[model samples]
Target: MSPASSHTHRPPALAGLELLASAVVLVDADGTISYANAAAENLLESSLKALSRQKLAAQFLNPEELDNICAQARLHKFSDLRQDLTLERAGRDPLHVHSIVSVLDEPAGHVLIELREHLQHIKLDREERILDQSQVNKELIRNLAHEIKNPLGGIRGAAQLLEMELPPLHLGQLREYTQVIIKEADRLQTLVDRLLAPHRRPHIVGDVNIHEVCERVRSLILAEFPAGLTILRDYDASIPEFRGDKEQLIQTVLNIAHNAAQALSARIEAGEAQLTFKTRVARQVTLAKVRYGLALDLHIIDNGPGISPQIRDRIFYPLVSGREGGSGLGLTLAQTFVQQHMGVIECESRPGYTDFRILLPLP
Candidate 1:
């Protein structure tokens, strides 16, 4: 038996296409899309059926250039010829990609277009840096919390002693200052405890239904903002339960949802606030430098004024908040909890939309 013949091969249509992390689309000889992989579906923000119904030119800014490249590949029967292209999808920002068009040697004249998003490289690098920074921030928070925690007790005790030492009638105005010190010390103590909570708490793992977590968060949000906020659930019932800390997941989702609700206070008062909890199954997602075959995609989408661009990049940083009264540890703790489960959390915000996407690996 020959060595090459001894090995087994899998078809691209069945396995190869789906396994790829990059967006891929198979176009027919007539320039109509025949197939789109999962990544392609995500990139275009559309489904396979929808993508297949349209021609390739519908997605490209320079359709003629894309057509010429594909035509040249077909004419010369060449493979591996790559070019930079911009894909313009309606209602979404244009995407820049390095496209590789390969002519398949088939009677159907199928051409495979592999799209490697330029932004993906930037995103991956940013995620790596974020992860690194998250670790640094965590260490810093622990140390700072400890340092502040020790002094907080002493400050509150000293204020309490001073209050007891003063006469109630004669020190009426003076007592108020001591009371303020005590109150502020207690508040700082609470903040320090919260900063240390994630690290101190043990992760208790069990089978977690992501929808359950979403429903719990939704219920909590609706209960708090019952009159004005509208919370919608767009869940995929097919996703199976994965091993995770249920309470932690609930808390993480609630923190993000609560923040969204707070950000939508204006819209809520105007009766225009909307929060959607969407759940889907993603394939071939890379999270925190590790790629997973399948992952749970949870999206917390809100229609509000959107997050300010100035602090958007640092939203996950400890003590960073866009809201005035925000503790800022909500998202930081959420990120930490999600990372403990080997997942990733990301945010994208603009004028009318803000999306927090959490990707958790499925076993």
Candidate 2:
């Protein structure tokens, strides 16, 4: 080695930069966290002893992900940009962090890194708004439906009673009028029930296995439409049980799947209809003005005729449907239930395949 090169050291001005910096983690090649800037300790919610020398992967969202990062660091020494990373910080919400790793010029095995918060928080603000809109819609339907219930019941009863009293000639005519009122009332009742179901019930949060939820939805859909479609499971078993209302989750997932099934009817007959339920862990997800260190990532993918350009943008809006016979409330209800659990759902649809991503915060 050249004499001047071997003697090079961290410039005096740069020595104290890391010591007083605002980054979350600092580590060496053995994956030991040798130093954590004050901001890092605060973000992780622990002190030096609890964090020092611990394997960086131990506190990460997925340990294997850290391994991948380390591998990247080893391969590309001058590549200063670290891709966004999610971390499961103890006693704090999941953090969506963007990071950078660079080779340390002096300390041979040292890698200097810095991280910043990412895209999870802004999403929660949108969810809060959706919840408000759903509540208003539910109240309007329930109150209005009640008004129709009383008068319609009286009209049907009076018609039947009159038919019994009047001579046989006019009895049939009165019965027909009553039948009209009864049919109309029943239809109105069904409409009211659909509107009120989501808001009328209390959320039952518990330890729910996401895979079971997927399996149940799969069975129900296949039973209803078996031949033309394929339902595949791509699950990450390490995903832990999260606190969620099982029935609500079932309906939430079911509505999306049902829509995909309908869209794929033609593809199914052609032996190309495909639906996949994929699960993984998302770290540092921000939803509903909150962050979780770990979140459930569920993807519902389908191969179909794709949504029409006209109504595609409004699919989740109440009363918007591309189908002639559809109520258009399925996706709306799905969005409400997911928002109740502080989850965010987004959709991407094109000519052949559509993807719905559900990100639920891990408990």
Candidate 3:
């Protein structure tokens, strides 16, 4: 549907304080847009003149979610409400927006809704907490590894030594058991190293072409799985090189792409998998009260089964995985690396498509 002209609208001052502070819109229980604030107008890409009398549920929200919002508004005059929702503009990666519903009683049936982007705050807060916890987790792992590692080596060595003395048939069985112990010990040591790498390393910042990072990850993912999967590219060539650590940038994209690929496994097997790497330039975006004005947008999108609703909010938390039999640290680590680069990552998912969008400042 086409939007109306942007010229007609009420003054910004009358749009309520909540609208001033947040991206919000007013809609009747039938989902028609009665009013929209400046922020909401921008997000919806339609001015007030165009938005008035438009159905909110059919136009923007998924049917089920729209019904739920309407139910809440109909049920009470005032109620505390919170929901995780997504907004995809112009066929783009879905923007992960957290919504808070507050009702307004007036002649025109309306529901006062506010939306806050989750990427900024969570990226900053979660990263700080994870970094600290990683340090503590590292120390405990190092101390434990050292104590058990020495004995583990001796145990494996003794088993090997005894195996050489035994007959061939019995030797093979004992040798296999010893190998298990060696393998497990090696895995523990590897985990400890990962915990320490981010803390011990110095960030090497330089003029980094965001596209280069996407290309590199694209090549790596294709090399690993060259069949039954498609890697689509949608990039804004105008994006400038940003100051970032090359290695870290690569890791961040890799971590996110790897997770998407895992989630797309079934689709890949069916020859219907798709993974897109896209970049754009977002203007005048405010994050954490500071307006960077211009930000680089990178998106990792896929068509697969969506993330489970259960862990959606905590998806970025350490060791939280949407897929079964997954380590879950990929996104946690990706978030950490992006935070180090002073970037933000937002996510949205449904049954068929899932999007992870990363925003970084331009150099």
Model 1 clashing residue pairs (backbone): none
Each model's lDDT comes to 0.87, 0.75, 0.73
Model 1: per-residue Cα lDDT over 277-319, one tens digit each? 9888887889999989889989999998888989998999988
Q: TM-score of predicted model 1? A: 0.90
What is the Å distance of residue 228 in model 2 from its true position?
A: 1.6
Order candidates by TM-score, high to low. Answer: 1, 2, 3
Please report the candidate that would top lDDT against the real structure: 1
lDDT score, candidate 2, position 148: 73
lDDT score for candidate 3 against the true structure: 0.73
Per-candidate Cα RMSD to the true structure, in Å, reads: 5.0, 10.4, 8.2
The best candidate in terms of TM-score = 1
> Which is the better candidate, 1 or 3, if ranked by lDDT?
1
Q: Flag regions of model 1 displaced more than 4 Å.
A: 1-14, 46-54, 77-80, 89-91, 168-171
lDDT of each residue in 133-231, candidate 3, tens digit only: 655654664576467656766766675676568777787677777677667767756665565566668989788998889999999999998998899
Candidate 3 lowest-lDDT run of ten: 1-10
TM-score of each: 0.90, 0.66, 0.62
